[model samples]
Target: MTAVGDARIRRAVRAREEGSDLPGVWSAYGGLLQHLRIRAGLSQQQLGDAIGYSLELVASVERGRRPAKAAFTAAADRVLEAGGVLRVLQDEVDRAKLPRFFRNVALLEAEALSRFSYDPLLVPGLLQTETYAHALLGAHFPPLDEEIVEQRVAARLARQALLTRKKPPVVFVFIVEEGALRRFVGSDAVMHQQLEHLVTCARMRNVELQVMPAVRSVHSGLNGPMVLLESMDRRRHVYVDAQGVVSVRSDEDEVSEFWLRYGMLRTQALSTEESSRLIERMAGEL
Candidate 1:
């Protein structure tokens, strides 16, 4: 499961378990640990044998009720041939209040050198204004209790720091459909504020924003909203968020195709100057 999905489930479970939300999020950390063991071709008994735990303890980890140790993660990484992906996140997990899955994404984002995104519906989380984000989050079913909403929004807003940090600024390129620009997600005032913020954010040196005109007959982004993230280590991942599903892929060919499509879409989009003017015009209509 994606980190966001894991976080959703963790929130539900936590709400029930504590009778109120706690600041710490621990989505399916146990399950991820167990899956790593299974993928490493180790039986539950074998994993228990290596980690000096009973098979029942191992089972508890799989069920998300218990926290796995760093030593266990290191041992599992070696056995699983994960090249320290688990180890790196394990370190951050120690200090993080973010859910397990979200922590993984944070580690990945911290290492990323560039990101390219397309959003056909709402603004991407990394770029959302607080008001816009809160309004959208409030609409989620099983409605995020106030504390959870606050935490999630704060977490997302914190991610924007990547744009300004020293050296190798996280290059960001965004493409949004004209329809997204037209939608008034919140009140007219809130939506107008968000659009104006988009205009200012787009002008940042390391950021690029483009709008896909609704009238275009031939477009490369027909498949819907997707993101292509690249790290300095030459790794690539494809992320798609649609129909209440968010997925990330590390498969080379799969991400490569999305990268190619993003290139084509960029070519068809209006120049940055034109897009800014277009956004400003839309903001005026509000």
Candidate 2:
């Protein structure tokens, strides 16, 4: 009788877990997609064919098992005549793909007029290549599901769009430790590609990339990685990420200190031209 009671409890717990695990926004988007398709008298296969996607892909999206990319959403919306409703959910759907801890920061970043970051270890997510990001997440200690990994990778790439946002473009400053550049997040080829990509990004007029030499014995950035964001209203915020934990501060005093530290780190690090040359050299060595 006790064994049967325990079995019932286990089943109840599992059911509740499954309920909480559902991707709410993705599911809503999926349901809307289904409604639109059905209203148009189109089967999943027919819709997939019209949108140039596979039937399985369409079915997966309809079930919320996969989040649709912006391109996919646009194509589907056009094909289904969604009248822009599907496109409206694209931001929320993309935000859901990022880890919960980073979502708020991501939102603040989108509104910022300038972003400055000091990365002592891994390359900042904003600047990471897809292959590099995949390898980094793939090495998470507890192990992430393959699907979750894909979602995170796609989400990371999505954030890179901010790099090119125009009409009063955002300014970007990146200070990366030399060691982080040398560390192999993925294969040698990936590291090489990433360094080359960095060089490319640094060439952008709105971006300033600097390299902190490993030889620097002591520096404030050694404390960990921190991101500084200045909103259009000139309000500044500081974001610090250590391990998996994160802290965000809006207090002027605290944020000002972070700005001071970042300024020091920038001066201590290589100039943009030098950094670009160094990155090019590193890519060549790989």
Show how many residue pairs clash in every candidate, following the order shown: 0, 0
Instruction: Score residue 43 of candidate 2 by CA lDDT.
Output: 97
Between which residue pairs do clashes occur in model 2? none
The global C-alpha lDDT for each of the candidates, from Candidate 1 onward, is 0.74, 0.87
Candidate 2 matches the true fold with a TM-score of 0.86
- Per-residue CA lDDT of model 2 for 134-235, tens digit only, reads 999999979999989998999999899999999658999999999989988889999999999999999899999999988887987878899999999999
- Which stretch of 10 consecutive residues in model 2 shows the poorest summed lDDT? 1-10
Q: Which digits, one per residue and each the tens of the lDDT, describe model 1 over residues 1-286? A: 3475456446645753465323232334554565567667899899888767789977865664444557777776676666775676554434343433455566777788998988888787777899998888878787777755765666677677887867777999989888888877779988899999999999899999999888876798888888788888989987776665667889998888888899999998887888999999989988
- Each prediction's TM-score versus the true structure: 0.66, 0.86
Q: Which candidate is the best by lDDT?
A: 2
The deviation in Å at residue 60 for candidate 1 is 23
